[model samples]
Target: MEDIGYGLLDRAMIHQITERWRHGGIGIIVLQLRHVNAASLEAVQLWESQQTRLFWRYRMENDYFFFLNRMKSDRQMKLILDSAITSLKKGLQAAAAESSVDERAKPPFTIGTASASPSGLGRSAETMIYHALRDATLSMLRLRMKEDETELPFGSGQAGARSEWSSSVGIGILAKAIPTFDLHAQVSSLAKLFESNTHVQGAVIVNQGRPVGLVMKEKMHQMLAGQFGLPLYWNRSVEKIMDDDSLVVDASIPVEQVAQLAMARDISRLYDVVTITRNGKLLGAASIRSILECITNLRTEEARTANPLTGLPGNAAIQREMKQRIESRQPFAVIYADLDYFKWYNDCFGFAQGDALIRYTAAVLQDVTGILGGRGDFIGHIGGDDFIILTGSSAEDADKLCRNMIWRFDGGIKSFYNGEDVAHVVDRSGNRIEQNGVSVSLSLVYCDGSEDITTEHISQAAARLKKQAKQLNGSVHVMGEVFEKHLGEGRV
Candidate 1:
């Protein structure tokens, strides 16, 4: 009923509890139990141990609705609060009859006796479990929202591709909360931690829950193997040997930025684990190996979906970009570009020259938009000579962008012609044919986001404007009800 702990949204803690849900593990149910239900520590522990088998069994059968369901609610997702409480009620009644112990027993299981014989769950444990699941579910929901909001604008179309881009791979996606030790913990204890967990590369040293230093396995082992290494440091505190200058980054930062900071470390500590924090408290750590691997996966996905001809994003990425912008309800404009007489040019000069023109048109769009467009502008190739531009620029700037695109396109198109004049080109039969070259026609559609605008609406508007622009001469741009403009030989 009270506000859930904000720290539970930390990626490591969320993964830890969700991992418990996935595997029915009971060792680390709640990292900060006090943040959930502080009044009864014993009840929290009892619920964690007693409820895993039963709860996970229920989860397995209903995993479709429990784990695989996507958020259908609005931007804030207000429904998750009620959905979490509802799921808790269902999980509480699961496997009631199969247990050996009777639920109606007069004396409920006490904290001391609950662990030894967890067959009968008490009211305290039930209450604790309810709050824990509710809070955990809420935390997971918020984490998903954060990932979606910060995802790269031009990511791939895969189901979970939002978190896979190097430009938007937040540290939370890769960081895992490995074992953490107090600042005063002896070096020998850290040595044991590494021995016990061979997969762990380092231990985060915390002072009152805040990360202060990092103790890496390779460096510690190297120190201990040195002259008088064991005697000099084995019994001393870990702080004496820990890397205090280790890189610490907030969890919301992109992994690409974090990778830069990680490599900037001294060569001796280049491979040290990077600690991730939330609100200045230790959340988890990401190894250089994990960061690099995440970056590689992101880049691979980008390259897979990019337009081969011009290296711009393709249809799927374009659709996704438009969809996100529309859903965001932000005022933005769409510029749909189509080349005029492209097929005739291809027929006259062959496909090779036509392809070169397509690439050149893409370059012109990029340069014009980069100079005149607002921040976060997007450009995509919709296959062939069709391109799309989405920008948050003002109407005046949008007009300028269209005019500049036409100017640059007309100027560079002469190079593709056979002679100094762009009106004539050599045909396949070695005969000269009259051709005016290719000119761009831009269909500009502006949406204030006040109305319910869909991608279909924008596409339809662009198609309608394209028909109108083709009726005129030279390169031109047309917008609904605002203005009709043309450049070069013909003016409208």
Candidate 2:
């Protein structure tokens, strides 16, 4: 017990004990002692030892010392806490009586209490400790506000939280902690909860701060309405009844990934609530209903702004990207790619095959950029067979990337043409084409971060450079003085 409260628990001891406690399936009860800072650490520790021996206590932070005990029902935990609170009150009362009349008017002790068992929240020490600390703060707040008659909340989180809406809205925007429970929570109590709170569809059961299970109201009721179900399982722990393998996600993850994870669940569990966490600690829960609605909104936004073919960011997104890069004052290069002889290829090979070629080109560009791109590099489709690559790489590196892309694509697109096209023969339309055999052209554009180049300015600059590529031989890139005249500076 680390000298049995005489010696303090440092960061190392706290981590060690918290982890072991979590793995051992223990519960945590936090108390917010309002007068902790008034006395020395030794004095506070001495006071705490006099309070209880049922659990080993550890000081988490200012004014908070949580105890680890065996996982028990909340009712039992409350009873234990009640006794501890009585002991603390008695000591304070005796002290006050011993002091002068002025000291009797004010008590030295007030506690904010909350408990969570290991069967609900898992082995996440950070999450459990956070909730315990938050509860203590809430308790102190309630006491100071003279809210003694107000019910002190102990589980899950606040019922309602305001939401935010933006483009590329994250899962955090819709995350909720509406209903949370412990493992020992009864079926009858849960049923009543669901009945009264019609808005909430499920509850997240946590141990400490880690999620152990999720209980959807519909599924629980469905199970209970069966033959003699209520009598058979009314008093059982939620661990046996909850969805142990529920979908959990990091809260910072984008909604795009969240939606994919949610949809990948089985058909029966597809609409289940997705629990969101922050650094492995339970933050809130999001429903599939809310996620889908947010996704629908995203799709609408993407449809209006994203490339329909490759699903890459389009002009609107690209423009925003350029604006941000320019504002950051960082040197970035933009590579504009266009398919040479694509007009004739579309005419000869038909639009269906033409789209196949475009998709193929997009894949090749993505592959190349992904390999060469720095942390800030971005790939965007500028509509049709034209695309853009933004990179923090220098002009030389951008030139190397474009050369590799063109070489790989020219070799890979051999299947796009038949013998006649490869032999520089006439097409089905009887149009004699050059021996170009459907090659690509690239125009590399650079902004040294000194110029405030807009997306329009970039598009125009690249278009001018693309003309130079069209003038060159099959599958060529232009990055020299030819395009530099447009930028008013030569690219190195």
> Who wins the TM-score comparison?
1
Worst 10 residues of 2 by lDDT: 155-164
- Would you estimate the TM-scores of all the predictions? 0.51, 0.42
Model 2 Cα lDDT, one tens digit per residue, 1-492: 334431123344356446544654333333433334423344445556664333455543334454645433334656666776666556655554454445332334446666544556354665555455445534653453232212222111211110111222458888787578877777777888999998778898888878888998877876787688788778877777899999988775668678777765653575578999887878899876467557545544544455556656677767766776777687888888888777777877899989889888988887887787675577778788998887889987988898889878987888887545464534456767566577788888888878666777777878888877776657878774223554322221
TM-score of structure candidate 2: 0.42
The per-model lDDT (C-alpha) reads: 0.62, 0.64
Model 2, residue 179: C-alpha shift (Å): 24
RMSD of 1: 20.1
Error of 2 at 213 (Å): 30
Candidate 2 positional error at 120, Å: 24
CA-only RMSD, every prediction: 20.1, 23.8
Q: Assess candidate 1 and give its lDDT.
A: 0.62
Any idea how many clashes model 1 has? 0
Candidate 1, superposed: residue stretches over 4 Å from native: 1-165, 168-171, 207-212, 222-241, 250-252, 277-283, 320-335, 367-378, 390-403, 420-436, 443-472, 477-492
